[model samples]
Structure formats: C-alpha cells, structure tokens
Target chain A: MQKVFGRPKGLTEIPFHYCPGCTHGIIHRLIGEVLEELNIIEDTIGVAPVGCAGFSLDFFSCDFVGAAHGRAQAVATGIKRALPDRIVFTYQGDGDIAAIGTSHAIHVAARGEKITSIMVNNAIYGMTGGQMAPTTLTGQVTTTSPYGRDNGVAGFPLDLPKAIATFDGAVYVASVSVDSPKNILQAKKAIKKAFRVQQAGLGFALVSILSTCPTNWGMSPVDSLKWLQEKMIPVYQMGEIKVAEEVKGL
Target chain B: MSKVLLKGNEAIAEAAMRAGCKLFFGYPITPSTEIIEYLAKHLPEAGGTVLQAECEVAAINMCFGAAAAGARVMTASSSPGISLKQEGISYLAANELPVVIVNINRTGPGLGGLGPTQSDYFQSTRGGGHGDYRLIVLAPSKAQELYDLTMEAFDLADKYRNPVLILADGFLGQMMEPVLLKEKKEGNLPPKDWQTDGCKGRAKRKIASYFLVNELAEEACQRWQAKYDQIKEAEQRWESFYADDAEYLLVGYGTCGRIAKSVVLNARKQGMKLGLIRPITLWPFPVKAFTSHFDGIKGIVTVELNAGQMIEDVKLAVNCRVPVHLYKRQGGMLPHEREILKFVGQVFNLPVRGEA
Candidate 1:
C-alpha cells in the first residue's frame, strides 16, 4: 500500500473547532496544502485575523502572529517590511476585512505592500453568531437583520475583490470559490500563486475565497454549498479579477 | 559623539535610531509630528523603515507586527492620537511584545489645544488601554533627558518583553537645547526565541493574546503581574534637588518638573526652606523617593499643567503623612514661576518673594 492521501505537513495535529457544516475547515485544508506544496513552509510567516480565521494560529505549522480584527493586513505589512526576505500572508474573514478593518484593507492594497492576503467571504459574521456584515447580501436575513437585509436601508454587499482589483498596487487579485471539488483545486492554485507573487517580491496579492457558513446561513452543509453555487457564483466575478503585467508571468 | 543643539522631538528620533530601532511607524500630529518627519528623513539612510501610517491605529498595529518579528520598533503620537492607538497598545501588552511608544502629549480631554501640557499623566501611568496590564512610563523634563530616556526606553522594553512609553509634553517637544548623543551600549538582553520570523530549524511559534480557556487566561495574567512587580521594584527613578533638610517639598514631572526646579532654586536663594522631587518613572511613581526624604518635611506641593492628576499618585506615595497641595494651570496654560511661588508661600506660610 502507498501513502497517497494524508494530512498536509503544514497542518498541526490539533483538530479544527469550526462549526460542523462550515467551509472554514476545507479552506484551512486548502491553505495547508498550498503551504506544503510550495515547499516554503519553513520560510513563510502568517498573520491570523480576529475572527474564525484567527483560529488559524493553531492550525498552521508556519510561524504565526494573530492580529486585531481587520488589522491583519497592517500587521502583515509590518512583518514583511521588517523581514523582506520572508514570505508573509494574512488570513481574514469578510467581517474582519470588509467591516471595521475596511480602512486597513484599502490602504494595504493601495500601498502595494509585498504580502499576500486571503479574504474568506462567507457573507456573514461567523464567530460572533449570525450577525449582519458588510458582505451580507441584500435581502438576506441575519440575526441583526431579522426583517432581511434591505438595500435601501442596509446598503449593498461590498464587492471587495472588484474594488481591490482597481488598485494599481494590487498586482494579482482573484475571486475563487470552494463550493465544488474542481473549485477547491482551483482555489488552492490561486492561493499558491498569491504566495508565489510574494516570493517573487512582485507586489501586493490577494485571493478572495467565496466560502460557506451553514450554521450562520441556517442551512445544512449540503444546502449551503448549493446556495453558494447558485447565488454567490452569479453575483461575484468568478475568476482572476486582476493580473498586473509582472504577475501575469507568474 | 558630541553635544549638539536639537529640538526635543528631533533628538528623540536620533536617539531611537542610535538605540538600534530598525522600524518606525507613526502618524503626523501636532507637537509630535516632528518625530515622524525627522525619522522619515533619516531612518532610511540607516537602513530602517519609516512609514507614516494612515492613522495612529494602523501605525501602532504595524509596530505590533514589527516587534513580534523581532525588530526594534517605535510609534509616536499626541494625546488624541494615543487614544486612537489604545486598542493596539492593549493587544501589544496582552501579547507581551517589546515596543517603545512616544507620547508627546498635547492638552486634551479632547483636542483641547496643541500647546504644552502634562494632562495625559493619568492615561500614561494608568494603562490607557483595557486589561490588567501596565506600561513603563519614562518622563523626560528637557531636551537632554528626552534623548537619554528615549534610548533607555528601548532597553527597558526589550529587557521585560513589554511596552515602554516616553511621556513628554508639547513644550519639551518644541523647545531646543543641547543633547549629548551618547554611544550605544548593548544590554545583555535575553534571546528573542519567541519572535515569529520563521520556523526553519525550530518549532512553529505563535504570538497571540487570545487565551480561550479561563484557566490559561488567568495564568497569563498572573505571569504578567509577576513581571510588572519586578519592574516596579527595580525601575523607580526620580531626582531630588535640595530635598535634604528642606521643610517644604515641591513635586512634578516632565516640563512642570523643570519649572518646579527653577522655583525651588529661586526660593532657596530667598532663604526659604524649599526643595523639589522630580519623578522620572511615572508609573512606578517613585514612592521610594518620597519615603526616603520624608523626615522634617512639612507639606508637599504638586505643580502640573493639568487639573492635579499626578497629585493623586503623590498623595499615595506620601500616605497622607503630610498635606499635598496642588497648583495647576489647565487648558494648555503653563504655570508661571511666580504664581507657583505665591501658591506655595500661601499654602505653607512661607515668606513671599519680591517677584511674587
């Protein structure tokens, strides 16, 4: 018998504490696989955000620094600037990146910081129960929006990847999903490329992953994936959003 | 190398560089803005990074990142800006990262003015941020002390794996005086085995403040308290001028301390029994300075640029052995020497000087 399948060396033995139906575990596995495949696990430093994403501090085998909510990019900026030779990345959720941390997100992209950021867009605040988030889709009901999110009152869900694509500093921007096996593989590819961009010292790179929150969405794990594929895939741009001339080579 | 004339803010920047600071993240604000400006111009030449962050909050978070990466880092701001950085500062304290923060304090309960004031004494000595944490606060009264204390702050920060704050007022920041740029001597600091640079030859490291389990959190708090206790024991610093054999003592820190020293000297020339006790470490509060010189003391007067904030600590230090009087000038106003002399004369029944 051959050992063809096992946990990635980049992940610790500690099991994840995510909700049963959550896609965070799958996303975590993808990142772990990417870190191992790149063979840069020993040379990379990661910054974890102040949400479910923050729990990554325990999962990744690479050196990690947990950042305050929405400030992961800022913290990553500090690390990368100080240790320019070491690869640095941030793991952040929609509420952590698109809400209170919005200013840091915009400025990090605008500054063309030589770092990678993975934005997991689940459209709701997961760790803090099902509350409304900036990425919450209009007409979507949440704990704070019992009457459903109204576009007139709550405004529209932010198209973060699209907005980030416009920044000249953001050399590589991709909107990926993990709703299917094929998309999961594609998400891993995009994540690896984001890290490659940093390894090359090209510029800022980001991969916004459309994720699922079954518990927060009030759906089963199976139905959550179905809803994400049906609704989210159509609303969000589904492929590489921006590839600067230099990033195109990578 | 040699004594050179420099503004307080500029001297602090130069001193930070000499102290092996490799990164500076700051936002430009009144009185303290020169610190960032000077570092932005000179730090790059020394192969250091100086970033003018979008705001104080971002700048301080950046300091958190660099410090965790084992880089000597600093950030500076004034009163309102420091308030903005409270969240990040709290995180830094919780994580026990080494960082030096400079607060060139301006008057404010809120954006009061840009003039010199020591109104931030409470915020600096007390943890400005949330949690049961403390920052070692160093108060420098003049340009020379500003340079010296800024250099020492980095060592103190690294020694304890905690944040150190240099607290000065707007007057000290803008005033020009001679500073001796002392040679840097390396302190025997513990190795940075906890830094998150990489895990190449070692196990992965995690720098986080979140302890989900209550027992783990409580243990962390106890560990930090032990470290703070050790600091309070070894780091109490103060200067006593003519305190020996004096009947009345005046107490102050930062710019007000310099003013109080002048008042003490002038009072002594007038044959009045006056003295000064200047606290250099405001957080440790230099209780030892008071108890050691308490004999034959009648009363203590606190001179400040705010509404008697440090007087509370002064009262605690003396333990109500003598009455503590407060002579303050608030809202960016400086306490005139003559007014302090008159107030002290009235309080202790001393003879009023000719100038008064």
Candidate 2:
C-alpha cells in the first residue's frame, strides 16, 4: 500500500472555514497544489482580499498580507515591486475585485504589474449574506436584489475575463470553472500556468475561477454545482481567453 | 557635509532616501506634489522605486505592501489626498506596519484652498482613520526641521512598529530655506524578523488586522493601547523660547509656531513678558512643557492658521491653570504678526506694541 494522495505541503494543518457546498475550498486546494508543484512556495508572497477570500491568509503556507477590501491588486503590486525576485499573487472575490476595487484591477493590469491574480467569482457576496455583486447575473435573486437584479438600475453582470483580455499588459487571462471533476483539473492547470507566467517574468496573468456559494444561493452542494454549470459557464467565456506569445512558450 | 538651499518638500524626500527608504508611492496633489516629483526624479537613481499610484488610496495601500515586505516605504499627500488614504492608514495601524506618511496640509473642510493652513490638526492627532489607534505625529516648522524630522520619522516608525506622520502645512512645504545635510547615522532598530519577504528556512508569516473572535480583537486593541501609552510617555517633544519667568505664553506648532517665535521676540523687545512653546510632537501634545512655567503666567494664547484646533490640546495641557485664548485665521489665511500682537494686547489688556 502506498500513499496515493494527501494534503499538499503548500497548505497548513488548519482546516478551512468555508461553508459546506462552497467551492472556495476546492479553489484553495488547487492553489495549494499549484504552489507545491511549482516548488515556489517559499519564494511566493500572497495578498488576500477582504471577504471570505481573506481567510486564505491562514490556509496558505506562504508569506501572506491581508489587504483592505478591493485593494489586493495594489498591495500585490507593492510586494512584487519591492521584492521582484519573489513571486506574488492576490486572491480576490468578485465583489472585492469587480466592485469597489475596480479601479485597482484595471490599473494593475494596465501597468502590466508582473503578478498573478486569482479572482474567485461566486456571483454574490458570500461572506456578507448574499448581497448583489457586480458579477451577479442580471436576473439573479440576492439579498440586496430582493426583486432580482435588474439591468435597468443595477446593470448587467460583468464579463471580467473578456474585459481584462483586451489589455496589452495582460499576458495571460483564463476563465475557469470547478463544477465537475474535469473542470476542476482544468482550473488547476490554468492556475499553474498563471503562476508560471509570473515565474517567467511575463506581464500580469489572471485566472478567473467561477466558484459556487451554496449557502448564499440557498442550494445544496450538488444543486449549487449544477446551477453554476448551467448559469455561469455560458455567461462567462471559459478557457484561455487571452495568451501572449511569451506565455505560449510556458 | 555642506548646507544647501532646498524646498521643504524636496528636503523631506532627500532625507527619506538617506533614512533608508527604498520605496515611495504617492499621488500628486497641490502643495505636496513636489514630494512625489522629487522622489520620482531621484529615487530610481538611488536604487529605490518611486511609483505614482492610480490614486491616493492606491498609493497608501502600496505603502502597506512595501512596508509589510520589510522595505522602508513612504507616501505623501495634502489634506484631500490624505483623506482618501484614511482607509489604508487604518489598516496599516491595525497591522502594526512601520511606514512614513507625510501630510502637507492645505485649507480644507473640503477642497477649500491650496494656501497654507493647520486645519488638519484634529485629523492628524485624533487618528484620521477609523479604529482605536494613534499615529506619532511630528510637526516641523522649517525646511531644516523637515529634513531632520523626516529622517527621525522613519526611526520612530521602525522603533515602535507603527506608522509615523510628518504633519506640515503648505507654507513650510513650498518655502525655500538652507538645510544642513547631515551624514546618515545607523539607527539601532529592531530586526525585521516578521517581514513577509519569503518563508525560506522559517515559518510562514501573515500580516493582517482582522481578528475574528471578539476577545482576540479586544486583546489586539489592548496591545495597541499599551504601545501608544509608551509612545506618549517617551516621545513628547517641544521647544521653549523665553518661556522661563514670562508672564504671557504663546503656543503653536508648524508654521504657526515659527511665526509665534518672531512674535515672542518682538514682544520681549517691547518689555512685555512673553514666551513661546512650540510642540514638535503634536499627538503627545507636549503636556510636560506646561508643568513648570505657571508661576506668573497670566494667559496662554494659541496662534493657528485654522479655527482654534490646537487650542483644544493647549487647554488640556494647561488644565485651566490660566485662560487660553485663540487667535486664528481660516480659509488659507495666514495670521500676520502684527494682528497677533494686537489680539494679544487686547486679550491681556496690555499696552499696544510697536508697529501695530
């Protein structure tokens, strides 16, 4: 009998505090595995945003700095600039990256800040009792959108990966999903490549992961995955949306 | 080794470089814009990074990251821009990161004017951001003091593992004066054992301000309060000019203090018993400066460029031992020396002085 699988060295011994049926745990595990696989765990610094994503500070076995809401990109830019040899990344949620932090997100990409960003898109504000987020579907019902999100007043959901892919500084941009086993593996691959982009000193790389928030969506673990597959995958353009010639070599 | 003429903002930037500052992130704002301009021109040549952030908010957050990565970092702005940085400043305070923030204040409740004013005294001393924390505020009244105190701010920040603010007004920021450049001395600072550069050969480090448990948050607050208490005890700084055996005392800080000193000199020449107490550390308020000079002190007057903000601290320091008077000019107006002399003469019921 041999050990087929176990916890990755990139993760700490503490268990995650994510709610059951939530996809954040899976995303964290994928990042952990990527860090271990790259062998850059010790050379990496991570910035955590102010949401459920902020809890990743305790989960990752790397140097971490927690940033104010939506400021993760700016913070990561600082760390990357100060210690250019060290790899830096930011873990932000849709609400944190696409809403209040929109300015930093756009400018960080425009500056080509040679860092990786993992945007976890769960459609709604997970930690804040399911408020309407910028990534929420137009007709989706959230706590703040009691009557369902209306494009007239609240605006439609933002396709951020497509938007980011247009920037010249963004050398690699991928939209991923984790609803199924096959998709999970693809998400991990995209995440690893994103980190490799940073290792190669390429421009900014981002992997936008469409995650599930079962508690906020009022669905079971199984049902939330189904909902994400049926609703989010079609709306957000999936797979490598943009890849620069330099990133193709990686 | 030699004295050179420099603007206050430029001198502060040069001094920060001498103090081992390796990164500067700032946004250009009136009066304080020269700081970022000077750094952008010189810092890169000195093997440092000077970034102009998207906004003041982003600049301060960049400082947060650089400081957490164990780099000596600084960011500067004026009143409006400083207000935009309040959120990041609060996070820096809670995380106990050592960074330098310079606020070259202009008149403002909101975009009032670019003229020199000390209206930001309450904002600086009372913790402009949210949370139960305090920033060590250093007030420099001259270009020379700007250079000296900017270097001192980095040491104070590193020593206490806290943010230090250099609070000056536009008057000092734009004014040119001769500054004697001193050789950088090695400060006995504690090792940055907790920086987040890398985890190689050591345990992983996390720099954060969030405490999920209520009791843990309270404990963090207690720790911060203890640190602030120690700072208040050891860091109270002030300069006294002719305060001894004077019947009238004038209190001020920054540019107002510089002007008040001249008022003291002119009043003394007229045989009027006058003195000046200029606080170098505005947060600590220099309460000890008032403990001894109360034998014949009839009145204490605070000369300010704002509407009597520091007078509150002056009143607290005096403990009502004598009446505290306020002679202020708001909306970017400077309190002229002659007008102050007239106000003092009226308040104390003394004879009119020369040139008034």
Candidate 3:
C-alpha cells in the first residue's frame, strides 16, 4: 500500500532536470506510476518530444525514441505501425505538441492510429527560455512576449483539448491539471483512460496534462501552483473529453 | 502455392498483403495507380486499410500515421508523385520506420509523360531526399520479379527497421506477365513489439523516431550505414546472359534489360560475341560485374528508355578508355531487338545481323 503512489519500475531512478516547482516532473511520475500499475513496463516505448520534456525518455526505465520538434505524433505513428502489439505513447510539451506538432497531432487523430499521446501543456518553451508557446495564455508575459501576450499581434491562445475533441478519429481525450490533489487524481484517471482505450482497441487516444512552468513563468514554486490554480484551471478545465465506453465495457 | 499472370504493379500490391501488410496509403499516378486500385479492392477484404489520399504528400504522411500505430504499411506512386513524397519519406527514414514503397517511374522534371522511363536512376539508387538516408531500392524487370522483390522489401525493411523501395518503370507496371504466388502465411512479421496498443494489464509504451543530440543522430546514422553496407554485400542482385567470353556487352535494367536480352540472343546466331548485363538491385549497381568485362571487351553500349541515364554508370564502371556508348529514347519504350541489333552490328563491326 505504501508503494501505491510510488513511481513505476519503468521509470529510471534519475531525478528530473525540470526547473524549480515545475509540474513536468509530477506529470512524469503520474504517467510512470500508471505504466507500472498496468504491468506494461517491458512492452512500453516512449517517443520523447523537443522541449525539456524531450528527455522524458531518459527518465523512463523503458526503451525510448526521440522525435524532431513538433513531430512526436508522426514518429509515434510509425512506431505503432511497425509493432502494433506494443503500448506506444509520446511525451510532448506545449511548444512541441501544440505548435509545431499541431498538424501531426490533428492527422494522427484523423487517422486513428491506435496509439496514446501524453501532451504536457506548460504554456511556454521552458528549454529555450520562456519563449511564446501556442498554448501561452493571454495577458501572460514571457521573454518573447514581453508585452504580456498581446492578442493583437500574437493571436489567441489555443484551446488544445477542446480543439482535439472535435476530431472523429480520436476515441479518448481529456485535459487534466496539476493544481489540486483532486485534480491530480483526475489527471491520473484521465491518463489511465487514454491507455485503456488503446488496450480496448479503440483507435487513437490522447491525454493533455495541464502543467506549470515555474522558471519560465517567473514565479516561485508556491506562487506557480497558485497561478496554475487561479489562471490555468478555469481555461484548460478538467474532465474526459471523449470515451468509447461501450467498447470499454462501461 | 499459386501462379497467376499479373502486372508488375498488381503483383507488388498483392505481395505486400501476403507478407502481412495491414495498411496502404497512396495517391493515384500513372503506371503505379494500378497498385492503389488493387489495394482498394483487396486490402479491406484482408482486414487491412486502403486510402486514396488527397495528394502524394498527404498519402505518404498517412503512411507515416499508420506506421506510428505499429502497422505494416506501404504507398505507391510514379516520378512526380514520388517528388511530392520526398519530405515525408525523409521523416519516415529519420524515424527509422519500416515502410514499403513502389515507384513505377515515368519521365520527369515537370509532369513527364506517362510512358516508361528510368530517368530516376540517381534519385532511386542515390539518396533522393534530404538527410543521410538510403532506402533499400530493388529494380524489378518482370511480374515475377515484382512478387519476389516486394516480399524481400518487407523482410529487409523489418530486419533493419528501415524503408524499402521497389523501383519499376511504367513498362513493368502496365505489362502483364505470369507470377507464381507463395503460400499465404498467417502472421509472418513480428508483431509491433514496440507499438502502443494501450496498457490495460501492464504499462504505458511509446514509439517514435527522433534523435536530437548531434552525437546521438550521428551514432544512429553510423549504425544505419553499417547495416546498409552489410545488405549491399549480401543482396546486390543481377542476371547474366551470354557474357561468358564475349567480345561486346550491353548494360541495362528492367525494360532495357529485357530489350537487351532479345538482341543478345539474335547477336548470338550471327556469330558476334555480345552478352547482356541486367541489374536487379539498382542501389548496389552491380558495378564490378558490369565493368570487369571491359578488360576483354572492345566497347559497351548501355540502352534505356531515358536519354543516356544508365550510360553514366557504365562509363563510371568501365572507365573512360572503354568507350561506353549510349543508346537512348525518351518518354517512350525502347524499340524492339532489331533496333538494338543494328547498334550491336555497328559497335561490334558486324554486318547487319543477317538483315534487321
């Protein structure tokens, strides 16, 4: 019981390289834990994205492959095709997934390529030093958006989870956050559901883990959590976007 | 075991499925569209997928998508369509995906005519797309070659986890010939040991192809190069006809290879010592076999449906002193054996092979 919330054996023992108070590590732990609980450590292959989360491959104990910027979905598609019996997924950050990888993700869903995508929405490019991201919220100030994400010039922030839900090909989708304990539990359940859909042969699945970027957001660990609760939650929301309940024996 | 008359294009699509292919994504193009049409009617029956994509670009990307899901996949197109697929082809190679593609070539730089052509010699054998990637390319001359080469392509692709291409010209795709099909095996390829099928009982898995660290991509590239050299050593394919102690030789592949064969046989009766060289593996080029004959021969004339494309290789193989001449036609099939026999007479200094 003590080890229930503990990390999965599939995750390596190495500490994360994430900046202080960043929820990327937390999201990683949750995903790893789910993999262990399911007992699929040996069969899992991870497609790492181009952001700081790109190295999520090294943190995971299982085999890994890295994808070009915004191309994790495409890479994941290939991997899944070649070995349809394995449980494949990708770990992508906001700038990597929603921006450059947007079209790929869209097409992946449209094709329903029987894989899972774990997208971490941190609102800024952490590795490149807080540049604007496609998911960067309005009024959010970053190194690139010094004027606080000017809607006039930078355009509107993308609603990723909702945007993806409209696709007919994706069988399961959700936008979960790391702000509260209740929300964290919900996020885990969402991640679990995404995997379950694939297990049930329900075609494409994706789970967007709404997270925080303390270093890039220019806030302390505590303040970052507070900001995530205050600003990001209402917008990103929490819940399963779609599910094939009938196929899953609901 | 079954043998049936099949066009090269149809043989390819059928052989792909018989080898455990589950998905085919392609757009229609001349010479190769028959492959798509066949897959559309057959794949669904095999519990596989077949989609006519919006464009060659979209078609190849769709192959990328199916590939990610851990499925055996392929796509077919001609020269122009292949040009559009180069980007996705690069991405597929970058990921080290096992994809099978069939390109029935037509003439080109711009919407080249639908007639047969081997102008894509460099593009198919040499790395056509960006990056340090080489697709294992097989050039098939007959419908039987198509059946056998496609099976080999899938096996090689899976063995190395890379893409394999079958380069046949319009002649192979549109022409009909007898093909003996192998026994259908249930589940021949290894299951996607790395695919994401959901982890209800065990753990999460991910499959992708990307290497960012310069040293890492380089290391992977080196690994791939080593694999290619090994394949080159083992699988370079060709056939020889009447070359044993011959005075002159004709060099070609696919349609040109067949055309050269007829002339070689006719040149035999005339007592002129002329042999033929047909390369089945375009990438490996069969350089040593084709060129070494020059040590004893007087001249080598390379014939093809393209203006002197393969002649370049012959010269490179035999060296400048060997007098590597070119016999070429453009956007059309090369004329029959008589046209070639006329040249054989001139090159070998023989009197018109007992009338044209």
Q: Which predicted model would earn the best DockQ?
A: 2
Q: CAPRI band of model 3?
A: acceptable
Could you report the DockQ of all the candidates, in the order they appear? 0.87, 0.89, 0.24
* Candidates 1 and 3, the one with greater TM-score: 1
Model 3: reference contacts kept, as a fraction? 0.33
DockQ, candidate 2, comes to 0.89
- Per-residue lDDT of B180 in model 2: 92
Could you tell me the TM-score of chain B in model 2?
0.98
- Against the reference, the lDDT scores of all candidates come to 0.92, 0.93, 0.79
- Give per-residue CA lDDT, model 3, range B29-105, as digits (tens): 88798999998999899998776654676567657656655578999999989987887788777766788988899
Model 2: residues with Cα > 4 Å off, grouped in runs = B354-356
* DockQ score for candidate 1: 0.87
For candidate 1, the per-residue lDDT at A55 reads: 80
lDDT of 2 by residue, B220-246 (tens): 999999999999899999999999988
Q: A30, model 2: CA deviation in Å?
A: 0.6
Estimated TM-score for each candidate: 0.99, 0.99, 0.81
Candidate 3 iRMS, in Å? 5.4
